[model samples]
Target: MGVSDLLSLIGLFLAIIAFLDSSERKFILNKFSNRDFFLVSLYLILVNYLIFYQWWTNQIEFLNYFEFEGFPNTNTWAYFISIILIFWFLYKIMYAYFPNENKDKVLQFYKYLIAKKEYQSLFSYIEKYDFKKLRSKKVDSFQVILLEEIIGNKLFLKETASYNFFFIIELLNTNDNKVLENNFIYSQLTDQNSYTLMNIESPNQSFFKLLFHNDEFFLKSIDHNLRHNMSDLILLNKYILKFYLFTSQKKIVENTEVIENVFLKIIELKKIHILNKYFSNFSKTIVFDNNNSDSFASLFDLIVNQLNQSLIVFENNEELKFSFNIILDFSLNHYEKPYLKTKVIQSLTTKIDSENFIEFRKSLYECWRKSKKENESFNNNIIEKISNY
Candidate 1:
């Protein structure tokens, strides 16, 4: 190979290296705005053209080292091939720098921030803009990458007050449902130990609150986690109960199925305290009008059966006795009719066998008697009925 040919090869190799580097470190190219990208692309094109023109005019041999015995016009073919590759690289650079959609632009900017490790700036950017507008597959992909970075660095383990950890929480709080819906990101964030850490570190349960409130889809996801024993049952139940409490007040009709399904899962898990809290708040929301009365009755029956089974299973447990008393107490005191309370007591008495019924009555009676002593307004009639049973 002549020196000119060797120089040409070196130039092509440099161009290929530049393209590969730009491809791998896209954040660099993405840093340019559309105008800047166009200018840079034009400059690169001019430089490439100048080099090609010099080679063509000076009769610079193309790949002189290779013997092109069969093909008489190898030089022309090589020149065209090189031109095609150079333009292809330029096209890719353009695409990276000037994404088609706003979401893609946001995603590219986020990639730039992450690549530069400009977390503080990224946090500010996240706080400044509403990410709901950028909900897309690219955003979801970015979120997964961001979450992986947070997890890999054990950033969540940091004190919640720290900016780094706060940034993570903020990112999670602001992103769209697609981010949380990603199975990998969901599992990482909701992993038993990681979730426990987040719960402890977060103030006022903000992490869980934002997480559950942002999307009803998570209710089903959480249910699946609970069923598979992939999450902390008690912690999740607490959050779900809070979610329902807030959602019920809004009367979002769409959330009815979501609420019921999550509640049923909690019942299946037999979280007595959570169940008591949910039912106490839930009963107040029911209108009991003609439209929903039958549904309420059916749900009430299901709850009664589950509670009855729980009472049997935890017959000797004091906590269960207190939960039962609370449920009954709330049902009686809060509602004028108190028929739901009556139905619950009747279910417990009739569902259990003779021996178990006696023990349940005795436990409930003692709990009510204790509660009566603590509060003067406790009903004596219920106590008398239980004692007689």
Candidate 2:
């Protein structure tokens, strides 16, 4: 290749680099914006064009004066067309690098914004910074303005953020790798006091601690939000049981509505994991002093009511049926108090038909009869209550 030809190739290479950098496809440099790429590419392309033009002008003059040997002069139309085609090829290759699905999605989001004419101010502010220096811990003044603009826009509603926060919480409990820890998306979700602006109830740095560090705080936050929080109550059942296992008077605030709703969530979800955790850990630990005993009584009352209300589902939901059976067996075996024992009997006897629950009923009555033999003074009234059922 001639000197001008080689220079043209260099320009094409720089243009490819610029495109890759701009589109965030370059390794490491992908985090940086396109400002430097654009500036450097413009300078190199301008200088290259000038030099090529100078060489072309000389070649043209030489051709007019006398014919030269070897390949056609760089001034020829064919040479210029070849250079343009190479640049076009480089630009077109960007689409292939992007992968069609992602490229189409980006294009669609762009097209949607174009149609709405929204985010013009945000885009202008974004253009001002190279983004390499932008930190999740602290955003610049312009970035803050952009954030405020997005917050105020009708397109981004508080409800949307609230739902998303709930999603992150659920994923934190179940998903792998402990995602959302020190992540960019997590930073965006909670940073720059954005949580407040998003109307997400999660208090700034506190949310980070809740997700990765403390189970108690996570439970209390769920208790705090209660039924008002997640759009899907069924999705919350496992967490409620987890909270019930971990929570104490110090951890959870007293709210009858919240407690009832939590029970209702459990009934709706009917998940075996929740039932297993409750039988394995909850009954053994939570009941302590008179205060906790009363609380436990109230909770058992609610469970009875919820179970009665969903008897049809209980008969069909094997997990729910098995959970009640375990609760009955545990209460009979471990419960020394006549009051808690009677409550357990009353709750279990609610399923009088026993067509589907016969095994559970038989096991429970056998345990009660066995208990009566151990102590004749053991509340004859409790056995009367069981016989009445």
Candidate 3:
């Protein structure tokens, strides 16, 4: 290419490079990044025109280098070589500025690990995943963690696990709040055991998506209905995390309970209050087992038992108080025999005192009012049965 053509091409190429970064995730836009394409293309045409202009005017300067004597000071072939080198440097610049190009390769590696069921490889996959640098980069800030893959937003994971996870993604924006938007019950909207993709906007303006994928494990595969009724396992896992953390620091427990954000915090400060709550809620129990055919209820009962037993073993609170009976109802209404085998009516029986139970039932009804897509209610006889408790 001629000199004017070359400069025009270079300028255009730089402009193209600048154009691609306009997107939020600038890593893989249109799958191309060669800036010189447009620059060099336009330069070739313009440079040829410049050459013609030089010939028409009989300008010797246009045909010769002002810095050199003729076509180029160096060998004619060197001109072409320099063009190639320029392109190479341009490519280097593109890659250096936008480094997430290798993310596809990383994802391929992730696929391989997933295929092998290599759970431990997750740690390395996250660490090795190439990230495009932006304003702030920190271990706590950016992550391609499994949670994101399963549930787009709506949750964040602690570098370490904890029980209060359930309360993490609270709805601050009333407009999008599930309660106001008629997006209440989790089971009603989502398939009983599918990945839920949510984009969670954080108060800090930075957000991460989480993907919640439930496998056909013991509890989920229990029965067709039970699987659907299965409790929000991810939320429960968070609860487990908080419970363990509190129990571990029981000696300083009184000071540990402090919750300023009701939606975001599980148990608040006033250690005595939390301790009293937990003491009055769960029973001293340990019950999960490793079994292939175990249903959701069976496996969950085991986990609850183990969790309760562990809590009680630590003597952090009262053994039997709150109704894991709620969990039992969760398992029964969503899973069980006929539902898994064929179509059948499914109902769950949770034993609770009728007085406070009525209030709980009312709240449950209110939550499901928008969804559930069913108008049926417990028969009067059924209410009498529940009242017997």
Candidate 4:
């Protein structure tokens, strides 16, 4: 190949690399409008045509059969177009690989807004920008800077502006290291203090619904926070439970480790209300799969052990009775038939004593009666075992 042919080949190669890198690394294509795509396509076609026209005419003999009476001469523009396209491709590749320019511009704009306390404009800008079009790292940087500004100013804590902050947070990508690393941002997203700050009396079930669609992402965040001990488990455990319950209703909890981790924390904290909420929701939404018997057994044992602990620890009879009813409801609703053979009934009833033993039996019977008709055999087996106990 001649020098011109080699240069054209390199240009084509660079263009292809730029396109692919932008598509994968920067997600630049997602930001492109239809007009931008059309222009890009036209430019590529023109460049490719200039690069290959002479080669195709010379290298391939079949073109001799065509009428080239009015065709543009390759000598006129091929070398110049080839050189221009090469530089353009190089620029694109560099932009895709190192997108700091765009990120810096965005950060500067946001800083200006924050400096001027243009809270409304800042929120509008955030609302208008498509975060998915940006690289995750850029989005993460934006979140860190924005969060620092908000927390520093205490801008969003006011009753009038709190919802705006929450709304902006809802738009942010939750699966980011920077956002998670910022303790105040992490607390606002996953802690109970968020509700109090927002003046919400209860956990908003759909608060995280929009932020987390992937089960693994949500689970990993929970696991990471718990593992690092970054969160106040006492204040956040209920919100965590609420998030799990919300996710359970929307989708299956696929990662058992995260589920186990969260549950262990809840049990460790002895948040009976959260536990009751979890069991109540688990019974309704999660099916007990015999295939995952080991996991089921582990989780069951943890909860049962907690219940045994509750029996001794809880001074309030009503709280103890509430716990009993919740566990009974969960067990009877989900466990399969021949409950004695399954070891579920035995593990549950093992802690019953002469005092609340009558209450436990009554709760068990009530749960049996409340259970679905198809669960009669399972409930009957549980009741028979309890009578023998």
Q: Candidate 2 residues 147-212, lDDT tens each?
A: 333322333323233333443343333322232322313333323233432443223443443543
Q: What lDDT does the true structure give each of the candidates?
A: 0.49, 0.44, 0.33, 0.51
TM-score of 4: 0.39
Count of backbone collisions in candidate 3: 49
Error of 2 at 186 (Å): 14
Q: What ordering of candidates by lDDT runs from best to worst?
A: 4, 1, 2, 3
Q: Pick the candidate with the highest lDDT.
A: 4
**Could you give the C-alpha RMSD of every candidate to the true structure, in order shown?**
13.3, 13.1, 18.2, 15.0
In TM-score terms, candidate 1 sits at 0.42
Over 4 Å off, model 4: 1-109, 115-117, 126-282, 285-291, 316-326, 333-335, 338-343, 349-389
Model 3 lDDT tens row, 18-52: 77533212323322345644655554554455445
lDDT of 1: 0.49
Question: Which tens-of-lDDT digit does each residue in 2-88 have in candidate 1?
Answer: 336536855986776587644345543443467665765664564454446546545756645444477645445545555675575
Error of 2 at 318 (Å): 13
Per-residue lDDT of 32 in model 3: 36
Query: How well is each residue in 34-92 modelled by candidate 4, as lDDT tens digits?
Result: 55457667765766665576677788788767636787665446556656755765555
